[model samples]
Target: MSDSSQLPYRPCAGVMLVNQAGKVFVGQRIDSTLDAWQMPQGGIDDGEDAETAALREIGEETGIDPSLVRIVARARHELFYDLPSDLIGKVWKGRYRGQRQHWFLARFTGTDDDVKIDTDHPEFRAWKWAEPSELPAMIVPFKRKLYEDVIAEFAPWLESIA
Candidate 1:
């Protein structure tokens, strides 16, 4: 019963980074053994804006220069998903039930060679570009619904419109 979890969902930001080919970036978390992959996401630091958090998380998790991503879309509203009961008290220092995230869709303006996963505080062990349709199935089961919502919300980015 962490004080934070008792409050509500953790404030977070997420990114759907799409390349010119319309493929979204996916990463295999270094901390997971379940083959759970995810888009870049993380807590929105105190006093930081959601968009800023999204960009920072992208750089920290994937080593992509924030300058190389052009904003395409922002989620119309925040989206939430709860961690499984078994995980609620075991993850994030038991400080969050899950995340309530503000998602951003950005176009990767750089080439594939510009992606360097060896970030300062690396969160991913591996990464790749995959069709947006595959996102929901690629993430952890608990977050599938969240991914689906994200994919739907950023359908335009998936079409390479940005």
Candidate 2:
């Protein structure tokens, strides 16, 4: 696949939340028949800020409130994948190409019991704590390298956050 730098890519953010136990949160998608799993993420909305989008996406996907998480670090990753002409969102219409995601690392201040897995539009059915290094395989192939890159850049901060 071509890098988003080579293709039109929309900016996005994926948030990784960790607990005191040193485990990172991984969400198992509920709707996908294939049962894909990934961190909470979403496209940046105009008039809305990136950090706000990250926090909003985390709450929307995991049902955890934004107040419960503390921002640690952020890393940018870009991937180029074809979005069929008809599938691009209105923001990317006319010349839509692909997406570029900037992922953030956060540490949850609340306990495990505070996590709420069900939401009005849940993207996750189940969530569990996993090692940060093992997260790449759980994401989509086109996003795997980006995930790795984000984790690598924030490994030290993640360790301390845990």
For candidate 1, list the clashing residue pairs, or say none.
Answer: none
RMSD each, Å = 2.0, 4.1
Q: Tell me which residue pairs clash in candidate 2.
A: none
Relative to the unseen true structure, what is the C-alpha lDDT of residue 26 in candidate 1, on a scale of 0 to 100? 93
- Candidate 1 is scored at a TM of 0.93
lDDT of 2 by residue, 110-137 (tens): 9877878888887788989888888888
Q: Model 1 segments beyond 4 Å from truth?
A: 1-7, 160-162
Per-prediction TM-score to the true structure, in the order listed: 0.93, 0.81
Task: Choose the strongest candidate by TM-score.
Answer: 1
For model 1, what is the C-alpha lDDT against the true structure?
Answer: 0.88
Q: lDDT (CA) for every model shown?
A: 0.88, 0.76
The 10-residue segment with the lowest total lDDT in model 1: 1-10
Runs with alpha carbons beyond 4 Å of true place in candidate 2:
1-7, 76-96
Residue 157, model 1: lDDT of 55
